[model samples]
Target chain A: MAKVLMKGNEAIGAAAIKAGCKYFFGYPITPQNELPEYMARELPNIGGVFLQAESEVAAINMVYGAAGAGARVMTSSSSPGIALKQEGISYIAGAELPCVIVNIVRGGPGLGGIQPAQSDYYQATRGGGNGDYRHLVYAPATIQETVDLLMEAFDVAEQYRNPVMVIGDGMIGQMMEPVEFKEPKKRPIAPKTWSTDGTKGERKPNIINSLYIDPQELEDHVIRLENKYAEMKENETRYENYNVKDADVVVVAYGTTSRVVKNAIAKCEEEGIKIGLIRPITLWPFPDKAFEEITDRTKGILTVEMSTGQMIDDVKIAINGRKPVHFYGRTGGMVPIPDAIVEEIKKISGGVK
Target chain B: MLKDNRIRVITGHYGSGKTEFAVNYAVKLAGVNKKVAIVDLDVVNPYFRSREKEGFLSDLGIRVIGSSIKGASSDLPAISGEVLTPLQDETFEAVLDVGGDPIGARSLGRYHEYFQKGKYDMLFVINANRFETQTKEKTIAYLKNIEVQSRAKVTGLINNTHLLRSTTIEDVLRGQELCKEVSEELNVPIRYVSCIENVAKELPKDIEGEIFPIKMYMREDWMS
Candidate 1:
């Protein structure tokens, strides 16, 4: 409703509030502590609930509790914190609850530094938590995108009756930029039909859970999740193509690093370095088809990241090595400067004599 | 401390509770009627910092400036707001809360000229367990890199290493010892060692410097 300067984390929190998310449960973790803190302050004013749970595990369970009561719910944490929440997330997904999870990722495999990183690409896309379930994943590169996608995530989660994740990194969370809040759209009231509200006349008691002892029933549930994922692949794929027309080199990146790659492309354009960017907005259902088309036009594809080339593996798979695919990145939360990216582009294009 | 308005740089490793310390210190200064402002220059990490609580700081009459998501694109002109004006003014006291690690410190390069123009104090927050530099020597080396990039001298040390959920008194003492060792070795003053009150009670009497309490938002009695 108002034009405000907001960081990516704040934007997501605001969007969630506007999108009728009345319940937020989260633990403080970097590069995403802002989201929870924002919620803690704002939720009370809106007659909503915010709980800083004991741990990430406890926070996810609180989300599960809120979602079960048919309240729009959300939880946020960084890579390591998200790892701890995976158990609850997996359970939430199995129960087909509608909830939004935000992961402002940092470098990881362990307790990583609180710097922007894209190492969680595989984790977010391939399912960070275990199970035969898939959470609808939206990877937002900009603060505005973070808000927009967070809103979209709620709708997607409700539509599929599953969990949705708005995956970003430290860069998006910390950066403050101007954003105009879109006019609030009319949101559907929380679906009370199947929720576990107190049993009333003509309605049976509703139980939402991941536990199913029957082998056939579990198989049926797995099949349902698989079908939902397949449908998402067909209908929910999102990506952005930048200056891709007749490009010699295509750079593939997502989240914060994509912006850096785009800047590098612009810089290189001055020197007649024709490079393009394919930024995947949805990391899950990774835009393989989009890269396939770009590969045909470009001589080679490069994946840039703030990690040790984690997303490059996915790019290689997407291209199937039909065109030369290269990896350029800095690990341990080190972001490649535009100059370094330009150098790599020159090396790949043979523009450097 | 020089009277010519200077930008103070505060930094530390992640989970070091540097954000809490910065917020408290900034608020404490403002409470004493100082014309204070804090620039959240921590773009490296997303979660725990003054930037994350910009609204809170702004509410307290302290200006909080930082790069937003829109500025994530390097092509976008760095649009600093009114906070820059006060930093340049001689009457204002500004604190720059640099991000968790070296990458966060890198952002200080842009404000190097401002630091050079005025008196500045760069405080390196040390947590004993974080980074590859767990010991004093390694921590100093890390701080040196930060100083080289930010062009600001590390004038003080604030030891704040503690486990998030299970912090004990022993941990704070260990942090104090490390801070003392680093202070003596680097010839830097130990400004204040941060500790949660629960753990601060068990701290030995020999630990130097004033003890600052960490106020986390999660605590139910935070307002009290």
Candidate 2:
């Protein structure tokens, strides 16, 4: 297929359709509005369903309904909108339903602004919903990677029977890039026999519920969920290490912020600063193994983010104080520029030698 | 070789390269010692606005006008009174980079009175690769819609179809065909066929409109 210029939001919608997702439930929000709009226009043509629920809460519950019925389903929103869907996400996780939730994050603790941001790092990686549950969170940096992950996201969701969240900043939705829709490597997704599809009176009907009336039953269920997350951590943790084998400083970044970091690394290279990068593609798994790739010669790890300091905690936890972890960030819809990141790296490199 | 209009207003669907065309046109006018100024009336899109290139264009002796707020990160919909300077002053060759879609063009409507009282050309940029303006019917609909919203008729069409840094010669020719169809249907002249210098050179001389060789000014090197 020829490479076509696509906005990140619309490309994600197309990837969902290509992955055979038949139902979409979402509310309108800036940055991610184009996604639901695209689905509204295209899904009906393919004999699929596109429903713009009255609110994000209603939309996510609709996702719960569709996922329980064994349909490939999706919902997308921006920061605040995604916040509204958290409870439903937890419910879906408890029910062990397979679905895809896309969050084109904008700056906010609450209604912060409509610009590119990575402030929702905790909301995505740490389950904003209640109870002990986990889901795969893929933070893709480029539009091509977003497309590939989105296509495979459905498979991963079904394979694990958990909701998969694909989070990108607002720039990911706004930027235009040439992307080819290549097939992602397929995962071994078992049949949805666990779904609450009608049994046709010939077999036992499948039940989909999160409510555990018995205390021990609920504990058992929670443990089972933890084991599934453990399986994910073992099998799905992914990261990208750039020039980390030997470097004075290793910078950690993800999503749109990582692209800016790449630019800063190039500038540092030109200045003979020798900066490396560890880009975590999966925020939930945290890619702790990536920290091992950093050579012992590295002086420190600098975590860069669009938020004041969210993902830096993960970096510290991953490294476990192996090296001093420093943070450089901009918040409230402000994006960190390449020059600023270069300055931060220069400061870190200055102390090294 | 293009028309030397005093005020050139660029409008198009989102991602149709309207900002890119306006930036190239202003830079070209400045190259010939024309006193050029750019009014970025794009309030719809937060990223990739002509205002983002204010520093670069200002360094080249071209005045770049954006919102009333001087801060580049401010995403408010406010337009500056400074825009009136270029439109009112005949000595200044002005280029208005209006936003994408009719909603974006509504910002241009605020200056309808000034544009009505003067000689100006509103060029509807067409990118066949863009989903909204791919077909003749869709292009015509968007053109008429923009006119309704901006309260101004599109005087000419600019073929600016591209896939960022990956644009090929065939893409331009494919866009030329669509632009020609929309041009003949709406009776709007094809004013320019804009593309990167390499693809512009590959274009046949017989193609309609002057071939405008443009650099990838709006796109970053990493974006490719």
Candidate 3:
């Protein structure tokens, strides 16, 4: 279709539909409310299902049920709501069901604010639910990127038989931008021969359960999950590097903050400072390899986030003491401006240790 | 810069971008040395209020009179002391960015005394793309409701019909037809046909109404 000027939430809904997702379960929340509203109005007309569950928790379990039945399903919510769905997400992950969960993150600890925030970095990357399980997390910088990532999120979920989380802050959820819906690629998915849809009295009933009373079987499942994660880390780690080949200070950010940092980098460049941006598109894999290419010209790393120093931990871990990593962040729904990030770049270059 | 009205009230249904238009109009007025003060009368929407751009507008020498607390997310209509400045001072061409819908326009009832003496034009900004007021009949209904709550007459219409990036010259033309219907029925003059300046520069010149080319300063995180 032609390029449409759509809010990030609306684009996510359109993209999900284009990706052949007919089942959507969601609850009303600020910033990301457009997604459910879009689904509610359009899904029914297209011979699909859009159900507003009683709560976020209920929504996710519905996603788990639909996914188990070999139907592509999704559920979306903001940060607090995402928190409520964590248990269901854990259950879905443990059960190895392929589904998509979108977290249009808002400021948080407990109902912190309704504004945009990337505070859920740790929550998203670490899997909000309990278990030694990891699902791929994709962080998008633009509305267009959010659409593209959500389309890929479903395939990635089914390909790995894991629930994938597509995450963005309120800014990415609320802002209007031009987005082109490309023709959905014909994804090659493994046949759901293991689904519990029905046996038709053919063979033994397939049981999709997470609980393992026996220790060995549980350990085997853990090993299998670990192996799958390892494969994803090797094959699915994604990142975008800008002007990093010969830079003195490299700035790391993701989602909406990355856009601001890009403007900061441009401002810094005019002042004869060589700065670069390392935006992590897939926050899960963390793009550890991107750090290896940070050239000898690089002196220090600055991680800018909308939260108080969450993603910095990952940057420091990836850098591994080779360089001092500085952190600049605005928390509790305060967004970082280009001028502030530019000032941070100046401070980093001036040896503000 | 407003020819007939020194005090202008911009109102519309939700998502019609009345605030965005108000901000741009005030900025344009301030650019030409006409003393401008924008009163953020919108207490309905917590996001995308003109008050949030106070720092930027203040830098341009335009007075931004908003809520007492800077950058407040509260929905309460806590009127600042500075909101009354436009009523007394005839030199300052003030623009009231009223909240969307009738409930938001209710606050204007308190300013009824000042609006009687002061030359004012309440422009109802219309976007044909919004679901509530997409049709000409629905637009007229919205206008009537706003007029009822505010207890003020709407003197003009600003056709700001767009679909964000997908807005075409055809969308503008289609919206003009809707505005013509409203204009003939309500007898309110159509002020300006607005689109983004980029699109305005590309129109095929087959439409009606004076083009108010808009350049947005308040934008998404990625737009920067």
Candidate 4:
């Protein structure tokens, strides 16, 4: 394995290439411009297609077209741009296409700041598009983790016949760290008998569309997608627990915020505060099982996020009122410093409500 | 050795990698206990500015003077007072990581008199492998424009032609040839040919100019 210090955005781009993804379509957006720039400069040399489409709307549709044709295709954007592609994303999911989409997220309800924020958690995990479908969402905290997840993201997408989103805050996107692209796994996936390129006069033309105007037919499709999501919940959920074996406060977080929470947890441990961390590697399929590992000593659960408090829902739903859950966040481009999180931990421990 | 050239000043266009080069250069000097300090004058774009790297460099005992409001909500161009203080420390050599384009060099222009007053080598890092600086004449124009904007003459040329991890020995050699041509045409000495460590190890033994093997400071995290 070869390791190099690379930014998160760059590692994702390289991992996409390593996964044999030969087609890319994306519009330029901050914190993620590096990915497209890398693809633009590198793709041509390898005889791959890197298209800077007219707009984010067009880009996602192009990815949809490419993925539908059986090419491993991808696209990426920051908050605002990803917003524009919601319609296309919904269609892709409805059509059950296997593709990779990365949201190197920035702050937003609208065209927010360029800085990193995990404001897109609800949209990403809940599905941005209007649909009765869900995509496998991976929220990687480190550059290496991002690479490993991304290298397998394509295979996961294909395996489930659904889209795979690598959601990360701007920090995870822009920060520099060593990332190693390991040898490609012989990921077993169902062969594409559904690709439109085939049936060359041997069979009828293949069609890929998400529209099901009929209520009952659409309901059947929705049930089918729901079953797939349930299977994913049973099999694909992943998480990491640090020092939770004996702790009173088990803080839950994902992506960039988990790093800060871990640091905060260390400070509390030194003071004999007995705090721990549970990081969700996968956002969707939520990693709800992590909550079961909490102990009798676990007095409280705190969910930390870059946004005001999006992932807290998943944490609460998972904990199911078994323990009181707290939330600490930094929104609109502010990163919660370690000290701030430590304060939150103390407040929880001292029974400050 | 390249270390002899103290008070190094780097100025180039956006994406020319002046910040990355300056960071590695400062780290190298600090590693040798040379009392190194890096001054960040990039008030133009705050995102990739050298000041953002203060925490990383300061951990290594290298004093970094960057924007006071670095990574803050407000990205106003707030240059720190400590920026020029390092230049006064005789024991401390400094690296002035100037910003991109004429607009960016305005901050350097504020300290132009001070830089010219000291024993410094203003390096015009050639933006090789990029279209604007692909040719000698075009590269010369950029150098001249930056010099005029910053009001400082470039004492030397640094061939930093690259395409991240994709840079091969041939790319470095090709860049060296361009630097050679520009070196002769502009009458500026070719001080170093900067390449990442991996490719530098494979550089031809008989290459021209001093080869300065450097770490990738640019957003090369994506390069495999």
- Scored by TM-score, the top model is 2
- What TM-score is obtained for chain B in each of the predicted models? 0.83, 0.97, 0.94, 0.91
What interface RMSD does candidate 2 have? 2.4
Better of 2 and 3 by TM-score: 2
Clashing pairs in 2: none
The DockQ figures for the candidates are 0.07, 0.45, 0.27, 0.10
Q: How big is the positional error of residue A348 in model 4, measured in Å on the Cα after superposition?
A: 1.5
The local lDDT score (0 to 100) that residue A44 gets in candidate 3 is 97
Question: What would the per-residue lDDT of candidate 4 be over residues B1-224, giving only the tens digit for each residue?
Answer: 35345678888765566788888888888887778889988765436677767788999998888776656433567888887787777677889998766667877777765665347888877756654577888888888888888888888888877666667787778878999999898888888778888988888766766787888654523223
Candidate 4 residue-wise lDDT, A135-187, digit = tens: 88899988788888998899999998888999888888777565577855766
Residue B92 of model 3 has an lDDT of 87
Ranking by lDDT: 2, 3, 4, 1
The superposed Cα distance between candidate 3 and the true structure at residue A283, in angstroms, equals 0.2
Of 2 and 4, the candidate ahead on TM-score is 2
What is the number of residue pairs that collide in model 4?
3
Ranking by TM-score: 2, 3, 4, 1
User: What is the interface root-mean-square deviation of candidate 4?
Assistant: 8.2
Question: How does each model score on TM-score?
Answer: 0.64, 0.90, 0.83, 0.73
Q: Against the hidden true structure, what lDDT does model 3 obtain?
A: 0.85
